[model samples]
Target: MQLPTTDIAIQTDRLTRSFGSNVAVRELNLTVRSGEIFGLLGPNGAGKTTTIKMLTTMLPPSSGAATVAGHSILCDSIGVRKRIGYVSQMISADGALTGFENLLLFARIYNVPRRKRTQRIDETLAFMGLTEARDKLVCTYSGGMIRRLEIALSMLHRPEVLFLDEPTIGLDPAARLQVWKRLKELLETFGTTILLTTHDMEEAEELCDRIAIMKEGVIAAEGSAEELKQRAGTESMNQVFIHFAGEFSDSKPNFRDINRARRTAKRLG
Candidate 1:
């Protein structure tokens, strides 16, 4: 038996970004297939977030271009946004709004029909294990709870592609595992194309079908976790990252700080 081939969900060519004096990302080329999990692995100042922002149509690239689900980010940002959901690292909610309230508001913003919005909100909350905390103010929710709620909000629109920027940044090990489990189910059930940025080797190895390792605004290396490790003659993904990112690279950005930025952006997402 033969199955039909799926088209690429994401494609970028010579993608570049700069902040006046500093080039954040440069000449980066990549592609992500439909229904697959693609991971971007990079340390701080390595341009992972910048690439994500450009691809998601949040930030315009300084040069080059990309397409998400067939809409060119440079030409049809609105069309691109319509087909994708972005879950930033920071929780996106008004502190005063309860979990249920925030979800409802986003549903309306995403244009989920008025009639189906309520049921959709309830279902998403339950799926994220946020149903019990639905009515509690976001200010009162713990870090993990808030993270889960943010994910639920991103899924409300049932987007064909989901961009998760360090989606489990603040979670504990157990909570992170739970998140991965939920994400796997979402990919299988909805055929969602997921693109996430992370420096965590274990997270990349477990959740990503393929990974692109970025350094100094370019792709240093890319492949499956095992393939990269083998190419580097290393025993683990961490070793592979270290090899490609280079030795004595103080110029590289801090991943921990980058993770914090991810959390902060969620509020803006």
Candidate 2:
């Protein structure tokens, strides 16, 4: 069935992925509205990353179908790619390059017009609060600064949808807040639909318009934070997660866990 209109940024119908006998994602159906901040919350090995890979066209589904930014993932993969930006768990900025240089490089890679490149880079830097450090080498940046720069690079081409896999991982509380602030601004300024995967319950509660909790390759629950709390008969997202997934981690998974999961998934593949 066709999605209603431009109001839908992403839609999936019975999307599934398997690694040998292990089903990483199974019959996953989801929809994200335009200009909304949608969160995918799950613990380690819960298939959040696998879902993202499928939507971003980094991996083909074992069965089923999906559409991103009005293009079919199966039939119009390039069209889907061109309309969306993905910021992976791993930072993509070059440490040797200055912040501005990194933006310039991506602008070129994204085929930003020659005449518009400099202006777009400056605008994105200022928007990301990186203008002051625009010429500083990325290696000199703080974790928060690097995250903002990575996000800036992703936005240079003005994609209709942005996928962020653990965008604030490894940052302190203050840095995480700053990133959240910028993300809200991005939505207001550009109306870009954001799909994010995060283990941080607080982050999801604060930033997401809606959230879907995944467990054992299926969606266990989905709703706004308040709705989830009501459903779980709890006062917090943490409790909500525990109620649905029957698991809890005091500390959210970090980059190490993310990498380890990827490696394991690759081995299975």
Candidate 3:
């Protein structure tokens, strides 16, 4: 059966994925309203990335179904890909290429018409605050600059929805704030719906219109930041996560793991 379209930008019904006896995501169902910033928060291996991979069509679901931008994931994977832009946790830019060159290349890859390609690239660079550095090689740019350039590349095709996996994961405080600022601007300027996955509690609370907290391959809690805090009887998102996912123990990796992952990704890149 075809999934019915509604006002929602994305929806899933009993979406699941498993590898042998191990289920990465179990009977997942979610609705993300159009033009809203929705955050998916979870600990490592809680199925956040697995869910994103399925929605983005990088991996097919083991069972169940989903729709993105009114296109069924099962029947129209290409349609979903055309309407959404994705920025993975790993950076997706060529360090050897100048920022402008990178955007121009993606423009061609996305099949932007030759007449409109230059205008689109220039607009994206200015929107991302990289016009001044447009001629500089990406290798010399700061962590935040690279992130912004990646986002710019994703926006080249003018996707209706943006899927961001840890968009601000490894930057310093100032750079993180700058990324947030640009994201908000994008939201306002383009009215783009965003599905974000993040480990930072404060970032989720600050940016998301609604959030779903996942644990053991299921949603443990869902609501606005204030509603979640009220339900947990706490004043902070950190405490709310603890209340829902249980306390973080020494057995689990901490923020240091995120740092290590960033370093490893950089080295691999």
Candidate 4:
């Protein structure tokens, strides 16, 4: 059945995906409203990335349907792609290129008008605090700087909904905080609705207005951080994750693996 929609930014109905005998995501029904940060929390191989791939039109679902930014993933994938931005865990910035060069490249890729590309890139660079480093090669940037650049690249087209898969996987606390700050600013500046997957409970608690915990390919629980904590009877988001997600692990290549793989794929692409 279709999920009820009210001021919705994203909605999925019975969305399922499988690999032969394995069912990665099973009949997911979800709704994310406009202008809110929604977190998708799950253990490794719990279908977080799979769901993202399907929703973002990177992978087709085995059954069911989804709409992103009012465009169907299956029938109007291109339309969906045009209205949303996605930043995977992978580092998308070209280390061999300067930060400015990277944004210029992405601007062209996003088909930003030639008349607006330079101004847009500059504004984005300043917004992400990368103006000073714009001329520097991305190879020399810190992990946080690289992450910020990736986010900036995704935002060059000014998407209405941004999907982030493990956006802050391997950063120091300070770097993570910086990324968190920029994300909040992005939400306020663009009113972009964000849906992100992360293993970090602190990141989820800090950035998400609401969170959904998935276990074994289905949503086990969902709510605001405090509401979930109340349901789990704990103050710790970690404990809440444990209670909902359990210790399940899988052999499927996890998001971190995909992050590194995509870096290599970009080199080969």
CA lDDT of each prediction against the hidden true structure: 0.85, 0.89, 0.88, 0.89
lDDT of 2 by residue, 94-212 (tens): 98999989998898889999999999999999999999999999988888888899899889999999999888887878988999999999999999999999889999999999999
Query: Which candidate comes out best when scored by lDDT?
Result: 2
lDDT of 4 by residue, 54-165 (tens): 9999999999999998889999999999989999866678999999999999888889999999899999999999999989999988888888999999989999999998
Off by over 4 Å in 3: 1-6, 249-260, 264-269
Give TM per candidate.
0.91, 0.92, 0.93, 0.92
RMSD of 4: 3.4
For residues 1-269, could you state the per-residue lDDT of candidate 1 as single tens digits?
Answer: 32223478998889999899888899888889999999998767788888889988889999998889889999999999999989876557778999999999999899999999989999999888888898999988776677778878888999989999888775678878878888898899889999999767899999999999888888989999889989999887778989988754545566676667765645433
Clash number for each model: 2, 0, 0, 0
RMSD of each: 3.6, 4.7, 3.2, 3.4
Clashing pairs in 3: none
| Best-to-worst lDDT order | 2, 4, 3, 1
